[model samples]
Each structure stands twice: as C-alpha cells, then as structure tokens.
Target: MAAPLTDAGEFESWLNDRLDSLEVDREVYGVYILGILQEEESDEEKEDALQGILSAFLDEDTMEDVCKQIIKQWTECCSRSAAKRDAEDAEVQAIASMIEKQAQIVVKQKEVSEESKKRKEALLAQYANVTDEEDEAEEEEQTSGNNFTGNDKSLFKNTNVEEVLNRQKQKRDQAREDAQKKKEMDKMQREKDKLAKQDRKEKEKKRTQKGERKR
Candidate 1:
C-alpha cells in the first residue's frame, strides 16, 4: 500500500526552511518533489529523494513555487487513482472515495495556508507604522513638557488623551500606507529599467555581430 500524502502546510514549511540553508540544487529538488508525491513509493526511494531535498533549500521563493507544483501533481494523481474500479469491491470503492476526499482536503489546506501567509505579512508590514505612531506620541509629549500649570481642577477639564492619540495614529497610519505604495511603485520602475537595459544590450550585441559579418 502507498503511504498517505503529507500535510501541505507542514511540507511547505519544511521545504522552505531547508531552502534557507543555501545548498540545494534545483534539479535534485525537483526530483525530490516528484518522489515525495509518489505515495506507495519504496522506502529506499523516499530516503534518497529526501536526502537531495535536504541538501540545500536557500531559496524560499523556489520552495513556494515548488509547493504549488507538488500540490498540483498530487491532486491529479489522487483524482486519477480515485476512479472506481471493477471486481469485488466495497472496500476498494471506499478507499477510492477517501483518496478523492483527501485530494480536496489538500487543496483547501493550500488555500488556507496562502491566506494566512498574506495576513501575517500585512501585519508585519504594518508594524512599522505602529512604531512610527509611538515615536510620534513620545515626541509630542516630550515637546509639550508640562504647560498645564495651576490646574488642581479648574484650569483644564476637557482633555482626552486617548482621542488625541487615536487621531494621531490614524494620520500616521495613512502616511505609512502612502509611503509603502510609493516604495512599491519605485521598485517596479527599477525592474522596468533593468529589463530595458538588458534589452538595449541585446540589441547592441546583435547589431555589432551583424556589422562584423559585413566587414
């Protein structure tokens, strides 16, 4: 009997963490991905494939890409295998149905994992804005420095620090979001410039080659 498929989230994290180690070969890693998805694969084959995958996973990006690829193939395999077979088979039919359900479960797990990842990144990115607000609040308090004077209970009665801080926070958060937007725009521009430069170089090289042939 083939082994059951592994959890997508756990497998994804495991691969990505290994990629952080900086020694995995992409070709070998690809093979390992295939090997792992082949349930009922022999123990020897599994160990050999894992050894390669374990070697160096320095590219989180690559791992993520491979995660999708693996899941895609695994789902297909499960679906194809799940087709009802003939010849004496309540148990067999049940097993096939279970594999089909497992395929659906794995796909859902992938969706949930991607959503959770986006939420985590958004929270982390927003953390800088929270820090910015705290710093601003501290600076305001420092600069204001005890101007209230002689207010045992008569000089001031309408002070809402919470409301003020919240307003300030809202402004700071908006500013931070705007800055992030600009930064992404700038990064995209840089990539475009890089691509244009490469294209220009390729054209120049082709023109030089053509001229040399004529000479």
Candidate 2:
C-alpha cells in the first residue's frame, strides 16, 4: 500500500527544523526518520517508525558522539536545497513575466493591424466609389456624344439642305398668297350668285303680272 502524501510545506518546515538541530551523527538518525516518514504505510505508523529509527542510531556510540558534525552537514545540505528552490522560483517568475509581455505585444500588434485593415478598407471603398462615378460620367458623356452624332447626321441627311429649306419657305409663302386670293374670289362669286338669283326672281314676277293683265 502507498504511504499517505506529506504536505510539501509541512515536510520542508519539519526537515528544516530537524536539520538545524541535528548533530553530525544525529543526521543519520534524521535521514532514517525521513525515510520512514516517506515509506510508512499509515500516518499512525510514521511516528512509531521514526522512534524506531532514532533508537537504532542512539544505540551506536559512534553516531551519538558525532552529533555536532551531523548538524552542520545537515544544515548545509538543507540550505543548498533552499537556495536552489529559490533560484528555480525566480526563473519561473521571470519566464512567466516574459510570456505575459509577449502576449501583450501580440495583442497590441493585432489591434494595430485591425485598425490598418479598416483604414485600408475605407480607402478601398472610397476608391471604388470614385471609380464608379468616373465610369458613370464617362458613360453619360459617351451617350451624349452619340446623341450629338445622331443629330448631326440627321441635319446633314438632306444633300441640298440649304436649297431645300429656301424652296420650302418660298412654297409656303406662295401657298399663303394663293389661299388668300381663293378666299377673296369665293366671296365675290357668292355675292354675284346672290344678285343673279334676285334678278331672276324679279323678272319672273314681272312676266307673271303681264300674263295676268293680258288674261
């Protein structure tokens, strides 16, 4: 069965304290105790295992007499480990800060790129509008030029346009004069016909009165 996990903080603190108090020979006992702490099957077993390991170290006269040397060596090892941990933590923080700065720069670059794209799009739209207007104006000019060409062609269609126009004006004047003379002649003819009818009636009445006088 696996041993219960130790809290890193608690274990580091306990190890630091034990290392500070250890004598040279007591270090062997401390190492054994740490091993037992790592391997004990249960939390309850760890205390008993630590006592057993300590008892084995104290029984030996050589370790018991070298307590001061053990303490110095243990303290030095623990200090080295602490320094290494501090350096690693500093490195991690530095890398994290670099990553954050890079991310911020990327975000700013994207924003600038987007703004540039928008400006370019606006300019493109303006350019397109201008091009469209120019095309429309060109088309209108072409249409007007075509209309002028058609009118010019029509004006030149009559080969003797100037002579024909003069002739038409003369004919129109002659027709007007003729029409006026005809209207005057028709009026005179109507008056003569009315007088002839009156004369005929008067002669017929005289002839009838003479005939009655003779009868």
Candidate 3:
C-alpha cells in the first residue's frame, strides 16, 4: 500500500500515478474511483465492489490487482484529506478566538476611556463650583466690610481685615481732598462776586455826576 498522502497535492500526484499505471482515461476512471471510495462501506467491500465494476471495462486478469492497489492508495488519500480538513477547522477556530479576544480588549479600552472622561468631567465641575463659591464668598466679604464695626472680628475670618481698613482709609482721604477742593472753589467765587459789585457801584456814581453836570 502507498504511504498516506499528506495533503491534497500529494493525493493528486498519487491519483496521476495510478492513472498512468492503469492506462485509463483520467477524467472517466479517476472520477469513477473517487465515487467508489466515497461510498459508506468496509475496505474489503469497497475493494470487491470496485474490482467487479472495473472488470467490464478492463482486462479481468489485471483488474483484481490494480483495483486492490487503487483501493489502498485512495483510502490513504481520503484519510489524509480528512486530517487536513480537521486541521483547517482547528485553525479557523483559533483565528476566531483571537479575534474575539481582540474585540474584548477594544471594548475594555473604550470603557476605561469613557470612565476616565466622566471622572475628568466630574472633577472639572467640582472645581468650577468651588471657584464660584470662593468668588461669591469674596464678594460677600468685600460688601460686608462696609458695615463692619471694630467689634466684629468673626466676619474677617476669611478676609484680611488690615487690607479692608487700608481701603477705607484711602476712601476717607479722597473724600477729604474733594471737600478741600470744593471749599477753595467757593472762596474764589465769593471774591469774584465782591469785585464785580464794586465795579458796578463805580460806574453808577460816574453816571450820576454826568447827570448833575448836564442840569
């Protein structure tokens, strides 16, 4: 018997060898042999069946030995073909498993990214709220300082009391400067009014002397 064929290529090669030795039409007899081998039967049964089938088309004396050889070779070829198909199936399963693993990894990465994005947004929102609260507290502190008396030390806990006092001092100094400027302006206006009254009186006295001279 021929050694088992390793793959389809080796099976084809073995089939061609059989055709050459048998001196049979490759297309006709090759197909007939393949069909007989494909039948669900025991090795002896298939061999006997093929021997009987080919005897009508071939020399009876040579057909028995050739049919037996053909059965052995083709059986090995079938066994090898089955093994190859099993190996291809296993390879396809392995590739499918790898693809599934890669897809799972991608899904996990996306989940992690989405979780990180949510955490970042949450942190940003928290920070913004803190900033707004601080701004409002600062505004309240500044406005509350206007009503501050020397007795309220608790109100200055979140603010610098010395800085508020300095601002108040600066405002008082500005008010004093504005009051001084207004007082100076009033004194200048009073001096201008006195000078204009004296000039009007002198003009009236000159007109009275001219009237007496005309009389």
Candidate 4:
C-alpha cells in the first residue's frame, strides 16, 4: 500500500525523491532541459512560467538556483547561435564579392575584344584602298603602252611593261593567299586559346566550390 500524501511541502519532497530515484538517460535529460531553456521568452518570463511546474517538486531556494542555471545556459546558447549567423553572413558576403570581381573581368575582356575587332577592320580597309590605287596605276601604264610605235625599240618596251605587270599580278595574288592563310591560322589559334582559358576558369570555379563545400 502507498503512503497517503498530506501537505504541499510533504508532497513536493516526495516528488523530488521520486525524480531522483528514476533511471533516466543523461542525454535525454539534457535535451529536455535545452528545449525548455531555448524558448524565446525573457529570463524573468521563463522563470515565472516554470515556477508553478517546478514548485511541485522544488523548494523556494532550489527553484531560484535552477532558474539562474537555466538563464545562464540560455544566454550561452543565444550567443552561440548569434556567432553562427555572423559567420554565415560573412561567407555570403565573400562569395558575392568574388562574383562581382568575375563580372568586372568579363566586361573588361569584352571591351578589349571589341577594340581588337575594330582595329582589324580598319587595317583591312586600308589594305583594300592601297590595292585599288595600285590597280589604277597599272591601268594607266597599259593605256600608255598601247599608244607606242610598232618599231623594234617600242615593241621591246611594250613587251617589258607587260612582263612587269604580269609579275606584279602574280606577286599580289601570292600575297593575298598568304594573308588569307595567316588570318585562318590566327583565328584557329585564338579559338584554341579561348577554349583553354575557359577550361582553366571552369577548373578554378570547381576548386572554389569544392573548397567552400568543405568549409
């Protein structure tokens, strides 16, 4: 048979004795304490809120001590949570800064590329103008040669002029072919370099992501 419970103090003393004799896991007890202490209420509010429940098994002085311990634990927990939030915010800011730098670099590279394209077009236009002038000069020479006499000396002069024009035409055609080949090679090399650079950037990006994940 169980003993009859009498006064409030006697009942609380019995409850405390029962709680002390219980076989509870330390980890589970810790989790339960943490759950109560981590509430958003202020220290005073939390103490007051738990007063009625704890009074069932704790005396005045013991309950006060328990409230103090809870407040201390709660303050420490809040501090740790705030520190974690600060670290995460700093990491996010660093990533944003890196992305901004990458964007700036891309913009600068695009500007350089546009400038190079413009320069190439300008050079091609200049080369075409020079070729046009040479053609006009060659036509004038042919017209003058046609007005010469049929004598041996004049015939020799006309023959020499035709030979010079033919040699010039052949040289011009060879120069054009060489220029085209060089342009193609330059374009191929640029494409290869571009691919290599892109690959390097991708590798670097992967490494950065891996490092971040590790953190």
On TM-score, the candidate that comes out on top is 3
Instruction: Look at candidate 3 and give me any clashing residue pairs.
Output: none
In candidate 4 the C-alpha lDDT for residue 82 amounts to 62
Best by lDDT: 3
Question: What is the model-wide C-alpha lDDT for candidate 1?
Answer: 0.65
Candidate rank order under lDDT:
3, 4, 2, 1
Worst 10 residues of 2 by lDDT: 65-74
All models: lDDT? Answer: 0.65, 0.67, 0.78, 0.68
* Candidate 2 Cα outliers beyond 4 Å, as residue runs: 1-30, 33-65, 148-215
Compose the digit string of candidate 2's lDDT tens values, residues 92-141: 99999999999999999999999999999999999999999999999878
Ranking according to TM-score, highest score first: 3, 4, 2, 1
Each candidate structure's TM-score, on Cα atoms with residue i matched to residue i, is: 0.27, 0.41, 0.57, 0.47
Which has the better TM-score: candidate 1, or candidate 3? Answer: 3
True lDDT of residue 142, candidate 3: 75
Q: Using TM-score as the measure, name the better of candidate 2 and candidate 3.
A: 3
Worst 10 residues of 3 by lDDT: 1-10
Residue 150 shift from truth in candidate 4, angstroms: 19
> Per-residue CA lDDT of candidate 1, range 94-189, in tens?
889999999989999999999999999999889988989999988767655654434522333335565688899999999999999999999999
Candidate 3 RMSD to the correct structure: 10.3
Residue 209 Cα positional deviation in candidate 3, in Å, after optimal superposition: 22
What candidate 4 gets wrong by more than 4 Å, as runs, is 1-38, 141-215
